[model samples]
Target chain A: DVKVTQSSRYLVKRTGEKVFLECVQDMDHENMFWYRQDPGLGLRLIYFSYDVKMKEKGDIPEGYSVSREKKERFSLILESASTNQTSMYLCASSPPYLATQYFGPGTRLTVL
Target chain B: SQQGEEDPQALSIQEGENATMNCSYKTSINNLQWYRQNSGRGLVHLILIRSNEREKHSGRLRVTLDTSKKSSSLLITASRAADTASYFCATDSGDDMRFGAGTRLTVKP
Candidate 1:
């Protein structure tokens, strides 16, 4: 079975603070993704990494950056957290050509 | 715009009954997948159907895709209370996977 783990299940931060959400996968998948899910809005991609040091912006990447220094780990960074950034963040990983994705328990972020 | 949209935002059914959901996408896709998410939990991959395939089955779940119509449907047979969750359809466009708003299903005992 594939396992994807997130660093934090819940987090609270003040406005303008820098926040980091980490994800690690044990399946050695080549693709990893970060997404924020909101009611009625669905899961919108924030960023994705196809390989180490390779990153691509998704539909909504504003105020967010990602790091993939290693194959097993992917980190999402919020340059300046705002109240609007409060939402459930999910991390997923999949094989290079597979359509199935294994996801980690999401981190519910609260930016006050 | 989201690549996929699920019909019937919410559904309620009794245990032992069947539940069906539909999804429509705007663009061509390499494959379509169905995922289930319990309340406050991560998503679990349920099934996947490639563009060239029309129907696929996994246990009690059945998925059918129509490339010409750009749509897909998922059916759960003999549903159990454990099947109560949000079901999402994701589209793989060879670049990134996009998910729909999801259908919230409630299976009452």
Candidate 2:
């Protein structure tokens, strides 16, 4: 079975604080993705990595950065958390060419 | 920018009834997939229809794609209360995936 796990199910952070959301996949997939979901915005991609040590920006990546130091782990970092950044963060991983993504439980971030 | 948009932003239906949701996308796509997300949870891939295919089915879920119109529809037969969730359509053209806003479906028991 393919399993993706996130570091936290919920988190609260103050403005200007650095926040990190971690995701790990057991399927050994080469592609990993980060997205933020808002009420009307649905799932907006933040960043994605096609290979280890490689990252690409998505539609909404201005306030977010991602790291892929290892194949199984991907990390999303918010350099300065703001109230606007409070949203549900989702992580997904998939194999190359297949494009079927398996998602984690998600982290609900609350930036106060 | 979002490449897909789902119509009927929300839907409510009784158990044993069929539920249908529509999705429309812009630009060309190699494939389209349907995903379901429970409250405050991550998404689960439901089904995928390739560009050349017009329809596909899995268990109770039926997906139909119309590439000429850049639209697709997902129909769930005899839905159960457990089927209540947000349904999203995603389009991918070999690189990354783009998701729609999703349709909130509520199935009453």
The TM-score between candidate 1 and the true structure equals: 0.98
TM-score to true structure, per model? 0.98, 0.98
- Tens-digit lDDT track of model 1 for A1-112: 9999999999999999999999999999999999999998889999998899999998999999999999999999999999999999999999988889999999999999
> Distance (Å) between predicted and true CA of A85, model 2?
0.5
Clashing pairs in model 1? Answer: none
Reference contacts preserved by each model:
0.79, 0.69
lDDT of each model, Cα atoms only?
0.95, 0.95
Steric clash pairs (candidate 2): none
For all the models shown, what interface RMSD does each have? 0.9, 0.7
lDDT of 2 at B42: 96
> lDDT tens digits, residues A6-55, model 2?
99999999999999999999999999999999998879999999999999
C-alpha lDDT of residue A54 in model 1: 99
- Can you tell me the CAPRI class of model 2? high
